[model samples]
Target chain A: MSETTREQIRDVIGAHANLPVDIRELGDAADLFAAGMTSFASVNVMLGLEDTFDVEFPDTMLKRSVFASVDAILEALEALGVALV
Target chain B: MGSEVRAVSAEQVALRDRLIDAGHLIPSGVDGVYGHSAAFEDLREALGTRISAEARTRGATRLTFPPVLPVRQLEATGYLANMPHLAGTVFSFDGDDAAAAVQGTRASAHEDWSEFQAPTGVALMPAACYPVYPALARRGPLPAAGAFIDAGGAWVFRHEPSTDPARRQIFHQHELVRAGTPETVLQWRAQWAQLGLDLLTGLGLEARLDRANDPFFGRRGRLLAANQRAQELKLELLVPIAGPEPTACASFNHHLDHFSSTFAITGAGDDPVHTACLGFGHERIVLALLARHGLDPDRWPAEVQDRLGAPR
Candidate 1:
């Protein structure tokens, strides 16, 4: 994966989320929800990810836990056979 | 937490046992069916009246429906398409008496005797408000101010089996439903959510209104659930009834043109009237109050006793 893929995701998350911490502060394993990410905002993140990756998330991965962290989202994409450039 | 770690808690089990022992929950040995105690039913009914009185004052017409919905109505509502896993269709033995006898004999012992029964072409009403749209549609067109109905019934069935006391198979839903201009319905839902929170909190229960969703079916339903939350179409008023997470005692739903299109309901300018419903989960609320206070309603907080008219 290019630095662009990861940074782009971080950018979208930063743009979509209404939270205190800067995007740079969140590690891949950091629980975004615990960091004040909300279900309502998570939807926008999903929309952003869908648009950014050009892949639609299947039903199994639409749970709140899947959007718990950046790492979890990456795992879901991997499960969907998505290869981030 | 994931469902794997969702085993019933001791507190929940104890409360269930306490209710059963107190004769509030009469067991039928079946997974879902139960005989409700008069006392318990009284509390539920009183809660309904007390809660609904405010909506009625706002000109919500009252309507009650039977537990079973005609198959056609469910079809119109698109319920099966979205949540087939949760659907419980009613069936019967449409054969001769001999067939019935054979089925009965097979069923006499602990066996799958239901195999003899055939589809009766009806479905158990999943939500109390499912039948309202079609019925209201049949009335031709909505009034100029649009239609508002207080509708629901008991024994709505959703085929989700669990040890969770808060998630019962059979329960009552009394909803204050609005079908009118988009703004009106949206505002109604927002207002009632506050009303629901206030009502529960006023009784000294820990109630909070937050984003929630219906248990939709697979694949496509995930998108639907996400879209719903994204649009903020559903809100739940929850109280910690049984376990770690608070149980949903009431819900506010805004069905944006979904029902209007399904039923051809329209508001002024003949535009599709947006719809919303605020539903109260009867048994869940009663159990929450009991769990929060104590078994005896008499021992509940004095202010609460007066508010619900429960004897102190």
Candidate 2:
């Protein structure tokens, strides 16, 4: 994954977080919900991710589980063949 | 905080209970969720007759509509934008053999088949006002000034799962909508806001009119709430149901040109039709009346009982 793509994802997540989120703390597999991301705030993050990446999310990608955390979102995007950066 | 008269009837209670027993009414057992039951038909028919009679007095046309609407049309109106969470979509199988396989099923399989077919038709309508704009637009330009349509509807769904009868998933809405010149539409909405408040008051409920924001959406939905306050798009007549906070039974909406522009509905001289709608959630009103009044209809004031045409 490109460093730019990683930065964009972290930026989207950090923007929605009420407090500063530690980028290092989120592995590519961490649960977002368990990390305190709200469902609605996560949607905003997803929309931001979609816009920044110029990628459209399929219906299946819209589920809550895929967005459970910063790591999960990146993994799901990778699975969808969305190239980082 | 203030006390109000009760106006519930034994008949209403009996009907509600019977429907619940029949599984027609699926109560959420929560405070605000509204449920549906087969018994609603009787109450709805009666309400429809009463509303139609009132429409005649006002020289309005009575229009009835089906409960389901095309998903495409709803999308065009931006209903998905304002109420995506509440809107229910109908899905169907694209599988070629799905239908035939269902028809070939045995009795046990038949039940599953029916469930499979349930998604085919269209989205269930969440509000009555939705279907009217497109129909009105199909007709040529609005009259020189405006037009009033009295519509009675049922099977409207909301996603709220409150136990309070006041907030049901499926309920009836007796609506009056106006489309035309800006003055006409706004005036009609304002008039109904007062009229609805009076009607609720006469029903023996202590009701008040207040500005209402859109139903809660997501986190950003709070933005929608703020916008509603800024634009003053909604006014609701609310009555205390089960607690200190009041439940909205009727709402008057000044949609401006939202529907008209979205649906291409124009008024005389090609002006965008200014649209407004007054929606009465009938079941909520009934619940408010019941909560305020006792279960005995005969005990209600003569004037209040007479208006509902309850037999003495």
Candidate 3:
């Protein structure tokens, strides 16, 4: 179930991260920004996460660490009370 | 806006007091807002003139703008989303006398009167180059050599309020913008950085160029700033003015296809044009002079006086 949640977050990142490398090749701890994800792309990833999980990120969570990696995004979603399957 | 406490260093206070005592700056009972005396204005104007002359020698076209910008244009820049904390929007009462009376009452009682006010069609210009791109885009493709513009000394507004005189709410920026191929823009930006450093040194002010970043707001902004620094997208000419940290009297920014794509600014061949701009803070430069030399321009070094051309 936890892997399902991770997969969902990865799917959102793959759709919006704009990473130069394929999403499948990146580990959960990979730095998306260092992999060519721009600030604008990070904003898109945030929006995609909000839509996928039906949770709005507060201003406090609008940070680089929150969207730094797939694991980071999952952590943020969990902090926002998205129940992990 | 009113909740956060702004810290002003003792050094800043001392510097502010000195300028005020020397009759160079007139206090407006508001932190970060002051009126310039004739001497101050004269010095600032002289700096602008010197910069304009240099730009003219480079065959740059001159353009001027007022302090306010069209609200629509401001929104289109995406500044509010990126740096909303620093943006200042104009708001005014839009109702009849009755509504005015209510607003007046609220104001008199120190109550929130914002409800009675509406956003005006104009916003204070955040930077001198904000309007340049849109204006250039309307003219279709640039010349084969692209465009270089001297934006004159235009007033720009930032919302940071502080007791530091160097950090004024409203200030003039003697700005220049260049648009063309990536090579053109980068070369222009580099040339200006060297020129800017030389200009400050010629004024007898100790100046140095350093990698810099805008004070992007919020947590997300931190990442943007880091990326910007890593890419060396911004450079600032820094000089010690009032505090321990040097003040940035001038800045050069290379907007890699950001403004061009946003405004659809294209090169002669219809390729996306890259843009770059450099802005010298008029007031800050003068303050640096005062801090480095003395408040009296008459007593400055002979060479400095000669270069700035004997105060009008």
Candidate 4:
């Protein structure tokens, strides 16, 4: 993954985190679910990811578990053969 | 038509029983509240099958929407101004002891806190078409004439409470909405009304077309109703549910630029798209069918079963 791609993903995650919490404080492998990422907010994150990557999420990848964490989301994208730009 | 309505068929009884057994039919004790158990789920499943088939046939895209909506969006569409009486609100906690509230141990000093957040996420979407209009508007203009969407939703909140399963607090509504030029939109509405009537008749339910009035708003609402009587925008597919009075199983509404103008939904040519919606209350239709044809799937008329895609 390019350095820029990782930073961009981190930025997207950071921007979505609700007030009183910041995404940048978390490690690269932090658990988003534990950090209070709600199911509804996760959907918004998915939409952001899709728009940023210019790719549509396959129906199978729309489940909550796959997007539970940054690591999980990255893994799902990799499995879908979406190369980090 | 006398009071001698035929007894409910055994098949109808069985379907009701199956729903009860499956935990879909929750008994509200008063026989009104529609959400207790499996009946809601059964109705949704059955209607979903029909909607999917119809959408595929009509080349409409199948879209499932969230039941909750943002209150602000509904406000933007003038929903509150038009139908405040029917609107249900969600209130939130605002008491001083916030921690005790989370544990459900302390009652908030403010009584309203017990209910839910005010301007509740969105007024419980009363109609399936409510959300689609905004979505279309956001996508800019429609292609040339307009577009079609198959919207199927459950747990729609209506304040009315009737003992008949057909009219419950919460029910499933399956609708097809077309937004575009008046000619195309009205034509689609008319066609669907005919198709809906035919579908009901095929199910062995004796249905008739009848003019209706919008459940209009406020002091001027009477005038609105009177005007509606004049224009006849609401038309229903009525089926005899109890003894004499018929229940509306489906309705066709022609909101001539009412919604489009409100939502800024326009056609590709920059013309305001006229909108029309065909609404089917799945539970009501099912109840009417059950009342007309007995409950047994095996004994149900072949034509009715065929229309519903019930397996032989």
- Here the TM-score of candidate 3's chain B is 0.95
What would the DockQ be for model 1? Answer: 0.16
**Cα lDDT tens digits for candidate 3, B1-312:** 112345678998899999999999999988788999898998889889999999999989998888999988888877887788879989988888898999999999999988888998999999999989998999999998999999999999998888888888998988899999999899999999999999999888889999987887654566566667767999999999977788899999998877897899989985658999999999999999989889888888889888987573
> What's the lDDT of the predicted structure labeled candidate 2?
0.68
As a whole number from 0 to 100, the lDDT of residue A23 in candidate 2 is 52
Write down the worst ten-residue block by lDDT for model 3 chain B.
Answer: B1-10
Report the lDDT of model 1 for residue B151.
84
**DockQ values, each candidate:** 0.16, 0.03, 0.26, 0.01
User: Candidate 2, B181: how far from true, in Å?
Assistant: 1.2
| TM per candidate, chain B | 0.93, 0.80, 0.95, 0.82
**Alpha carbon lDDT at B288, candidate 3:** 91
lDDT of 2 by residue, A22-59 (tens): 75677767766566664345667767777777776665
Each candidate structure's TM-score, on Cα atoms with residue i matched to residue i, is 0.77, 0.66, 0.85, 0.66
DockQ comparison, 2 vs 4, better candidate: 2
Angstrom error at residue B133, model 2: 0.3
lDDT of 2 by residue, B1-312 (tens): 101122344444454564466554566655334355444444445556666676667767777788888887887865576567778777665445756566457435645544444455578887898888888889878888677888875568766554344556667888888898888877777777877777778777899999876664543454445445545788988887665567788888888777887788877785657898888877777666545664444566777767766545
Displacement of residue B68 (Cα, Å) in model 3 is 1.1
- Among these predictions, the greatest lDDT belongs to 3
Instruction: Quote the lDDT for B41 in model 4.
Output: 45
**Model 3 regions more than 4 Å off:** A1-10, A14-37, A46-85, B1-7, B108-111
Q: Which stretches in model 2 have alpha-carbon errors above 4 Å? A: A1-85, B1-46, B93-121
